[model samples]
Each structure stands twice: as C-alpha cells, then as structure tokens.
Target chain A: MPTQILYKPLTPEQEKRRRQRNIAIALSVAALVAIFYAITLVRLGSNVFLRPD
Target chain B: MSLVSESDLGQQSDFGSAASDASPSDYVALLKPRVMSLSIFTAFAGMLMAPHPVHPMIGAIALLAIAVGAGASGALNMWYDSDIDRLMARTANRPIPAGRMARGEALAFGLVLSAFAVLTLGLAANWLAGGLLAFTIFYYVVVYTMWLKRSTPQNIVIGGAAGALPPMVGYAAAAGSLDLSSLLLFTLIFVWTPPHFWSLALVKAGDYGRAGVPMAPNVWGPDATRLQILLYSLLLAPIGALPWILGYAGPVYGAIACLGGLGMILGGWAVFSRREGDLARKTAMRNFGFSILYLFTLFAVLVVERLTTIWLGA
Candidate 1:
C-alpha cells in the first residue's frame, strides 16, 4: 500500500497560480518536444535509412 | 496592497530562502551526476561510432554540454516535482524539497544552466549538436516532466526520446550529420527505456502513487507493467545488437551486446514470472541495476574496439 501525503489544499487563487505554473511547465516541455520532433523531421529529409527499406 | 500582480505573489510564495554560496557539492549535485554519467557514456558511443575526426578539446566540450544539459533537465525536474518530491522518501532529501533550496531558485538555476549548455554547445560545436542538446534538455523538462508524468501511464515510454538524444548529439558533434549507426544506437536506448524505468517504478510505486504521479504500476497495475517490462526487454536484445549487425563494431562489441541485452531480457522475464515477494523484487532490482551496467559495457566496448583498431593501425 502507498502512503498518501496531504498537500495544503490551496485557496482558489493559489490553485489558479499552481495551474498557471503547470501550464508553463507543460508549454516548456512541449516546446522542447516540438524542437526535437522538428529536428527529426528535418533530419528525415536526409535520413534515407529511416526511409522505406 | 493594490499594485503587486498575482503572478508576482505566486512567485514570491514559491521562492524559498536563498541558498548559501552554492556549495561545491551542491553544484556537482546540480549536474545530476548519475544521469550525466549515463549521458556521457552514450555521447562517447555516438562520437566513437561516427566517422570523422574531432579535436579532443571540442570533444571534451561536447561531453560537457551533454552533461550540463542533463543536469539542467534534472534541476528543472526537481523544481517542478518539488511538491510531490516532498512526499516520496526516495526523493525527499534532494536539495530542493529538503528545504535546503527554494523551488523558484531551483527552477531559475535550471533554466539558466539549460540555456548555457545549449548556447555553449552551439558555439563550441556545430549548431546541429547544439540544437540536439537543446532539444534533449527541453524533451526531458517538458515532455517527460510536465506532459507524460501525471497525465498518462505511458510517460516513460514517450518521454524517453530526450534520454535517447545524447548519442545523436555525440554523433552530430563528431560527424556533423546523421547516419544509420547513430540512429540505430538511438533506437537501442529508446527501446530500453521502459524496462529500465519500470523496474524502479515497480519498487517505488508507493512513492510515485503517493505523489500523484501516474507511474505504470499506479495507473495500469503491477501485472500489466511487469508484462510491458518483459516486452521491451525482448525488443532490447536485437536493437542493442545493431552496431555489430551494421558492421560499425567488431566481434568483441557484438558478442557483448548480444549477451548483455539477452541477459537483461532473461533477468526481466524471470522477475516477471516470479511470485511477488522479496525474491521477485530482488530479481527486478538486479535486472534494473544490471541494465545500467549493460548499457555502459555495451558502449564502453565501442570505445575500446575503436582504440584497438587505431593502436594496431587497422
């Protein structure tokens, strides 16, 4: 069984800020993934090996 | 009372006491040395397998970038997960959640280091390598840390792309381009991610679940996760044999990779087939621990093989 640790349940305003922070984290990661994906797509132009065998 | 924005208030609340002169040990901790050691190994493999000459200084810089980039990701991960980290015993003592450092401070430090790693790698090496380094940092921070973590059970699987990027960065640094062997090397790590991660996840399921992290065992249940671990280990055996199959590495590396990857699969399978008890946990831990050694040996063999060829002037 896992232990459930309690967080100081936030005020609505605090919750909103936490949500914003989560969004910022998500966007930052998404941007990085997009960059990596873009790199893959760019390299795929020259990556004939990733092309059909 | 009227002028300060809500955003400022939140930032202030998150920010904790200032850290003292960034202790030398603390700075080293920032690099996430365990992660760096793995990144450095894969980067070295990428460099070794690539067909080109690299000035030793440039090569050193490239490794440093990968190391710093990995640390940057770790710091950012710590920053974001501090809330949950405070719950998990395994992670509770990390610099941030331990209250030794502020959450905001950790995030700022991570962002700064991430930028520095990417910028210097781009400047010191070619932009291709720099670009890859930047992508890796982002991938770990965003894709893994933010997206997949709490959002889905497949977190480690999809998020593994960042971890797989180091070999490519190393390859791009040395050769200034892509090739079959490099991508193959990348694939090996990508496939290995699930088993390597899930084993730890299995043991730490309580920690992860308590923190609201959607680890596979938490989200999908232990049995399914165990099956998934086995499936990936099977995939690992063949993919890890690529360097030899592709003729980039000699029989020595080929044999080791095959044996090592196969051993990983067997160990993982044995754990899966076992009854849930100390024996099973120990088996899984052994497989998990061995996976690290397997990867290092597989790559280290490449360096030795290359130097051997050079020494014999082959």
Candidate 2:
C-alpha cells in the first residue's frame, strides 16, 4: 500500500538562511566572472583603452 | 489489499522523485573543479610561453574552452565509475554515488559540455586546438576511464597523455602550432605523473583493490611500485631541466628546477627505501606532495621569468 506524505513549509528562520546562502553563492559567481574579465583586460594591454591617434 | 487513493500515489511518486532532484552545486561537483584548475593553469602557461602573440580575447576563450573540456572529461569519468566510486571510501560521496545527481543526468551534462567546449573553441580559435580538446576528452573518457582503468596496472602511465596534452593545445591556440618548448612541457608533465599517481596508489591500494581497479601497488606489489616511482623520478629530473637547457627559461628557473628535481628524486628514494608498513606510506605520501610542489615551482618560475622579461625588458 502507498502512504501519503505531506509537504512542510519552511520556517521564517530557515527561509532567511536559504535566501542568505543563495545570495552568497550568486555573489561568489559574480565575483569570479568579474575577475576573469579583469584579467582579460589586463592581458589586452594599454592598447585596449589608449589610442595613439 | 484495499485500493490506494490517487493522493497517496501522487505523494509516493513525489517522494521517489525527490532522490533525483539536484541543485546547481551538484552539477558543479560533477566538474571536478580542482582538476580543471590544474589544466587551466598549465594551459595558461603554455599559452604564455608561445613566441607568437595571441589576441587576449582569443586566449581567454581558448582557456575557457579547455577548462570546460576538462570538466566534461571529469564528469564522464564520474558517470562511468560511479559504481566503483561507491565502493571506494574516498569517492563514495561524489554526486552520482551519493545520489545527489542521477547517472543519466551526469552523462548528458558531460556530453553537452564536451560539445560546447569543442565547438566554441573551433569557432573562436583555430581548429587544431578544438580538435585536440575533442581528442583529449575522447582519450580520457573512452581510453582511460572505460578501458585501461579496470584492465591494466599501467593505467596512469598511458592515460597520463590526456592530461599532458593540454599544454600542446594551448600552444596551438596561441601560436597555431607546437614547438620543442611546448613538447618539453608536455614531456615534463607526462614523466611526473607516474611517480605522483603511484605514491597515491601506494596509500590507497586497499581502496583500489576493493573497487576492482588494477592500480600499480595492487598488481605489482608495493616494492615494485616504489622502484617504478624511483625510475620515473630519475627520468623526470633531467626532463625538468630541459626548459633551461633549451634556452627558454632563465638561470633562476634552472636552479629551482635542478633543486626541485633533486628533491623529487630524494622523495622517491625515501619511498623506495622504506619498504613496508606506515613508514612507507608516509614516505610515499611525502613524495606525492613533493611532486606537486616540484611541478608547481618549475612552472611558477617559468611564468614569472617570462612576465618579468616582458615587463622590464630585462
């Protein structure tokens, strides 16, 4: 026989923690992407931003 | 038995489906990020070592493709070896084995990433780099994981070529071809792999035995494995010195390489001399740790020397 299982809603504190963790992860990934971009700019040298003309 | 309600069936199905649910982190875990980092660093070194200049955007894209390809290979390996991985303590908690991700999901993810990496590289960079990336993925997944890992004790020895080829790929990306310097980089990593991996195998022989994988220490006995490590170390030391001999690296790099090479040889000697028990395990691990340091130091010196030469015109 199959048994029924009820879904439980998260408590306020648990929801807060989940939101915080997600934000942290999103920020970390954003930081990593930014760093890769910065490295690319540096590698491209002054010619990227400066023009002799 | 009484008939079950539709609600009960729905709940049961939901409970069953929960096990297959995966988070973003689970997908990332399939990538083996540490291994990808090593590939990225070595490939970056190869790109920097090239005599020809690469457009920065192209170089970045090439590296990104290499990293994705490495991750794809790692994911495929995890998917195929999930059964043995469950048997081994060290890998028992990987995504597939731990049930965080399904086997089919991992397989599809790996295949998608592999195609994405290869196609992106082919379109953005030269076809040669893309071709090499595709070949590396095929070699690691098909040759190493599916075939050699279970069949032979020489698994790492032969399979190390896939790991060794990233530098060549990077060189091809930057310069559109390879040269002696890039080949030396490839050779150095190839020779270093055996001693590094064998040391780990010595420590994990029981795990490998349990998993039915024919690692060197299990097949050849610890004594023979130690001797092999020593022999490889001897070959590796001279190969480590080749960058300077070829006039690519400066004297500082040469000195560090010589000292690091000697240290690697001595570490191997320590492993070889301590023939049994915990002492042998410790020494083997020490050799393993030193081998990583040796490779990192050699590459670091090369990169630093090149950067300084370009910056200061020294």
In the range B1-314, model 2's lDDT, one tens digit per residue, is 43544465333231123324456667788999998988998888888788866777778888998998999999999989999999999999998788666687789889988998898777667888899999999999999999999999999999999999898888888888889988999999999999999999999999999999999999999999999999999999999999998898899989998999999889989999998788888898888888988988888888788778767753
Please name the candidate that would achieve the greatest TM-score relative to the true structure.
Answer: 2
Please report, as a residue range, the 10-residue window in candidate 2 chain B with the lowest summed lDDT.
B10-19
Clashes of each: 1, 0
Tens-digit lDDT track of model 1 for A5-42: 33334566545545655565577568556544544454
Among these predictions, the greatest lDDT belongs to 2
Instruction: Give the CAPRI class of candidate 2.
Output: incorrect
Model 2: residues >4 Å from true position, as ranges?
A1-53, B1-19
| DockQ for all candidate structures vs. native | 0.02, 0.10
Per-prediction share of native contacts kept: 0.00, 0.00
Model 2 Cα shift for residue B66 (angstroms): 0.5
TM per candidate, chain B = 0.92, 0.93
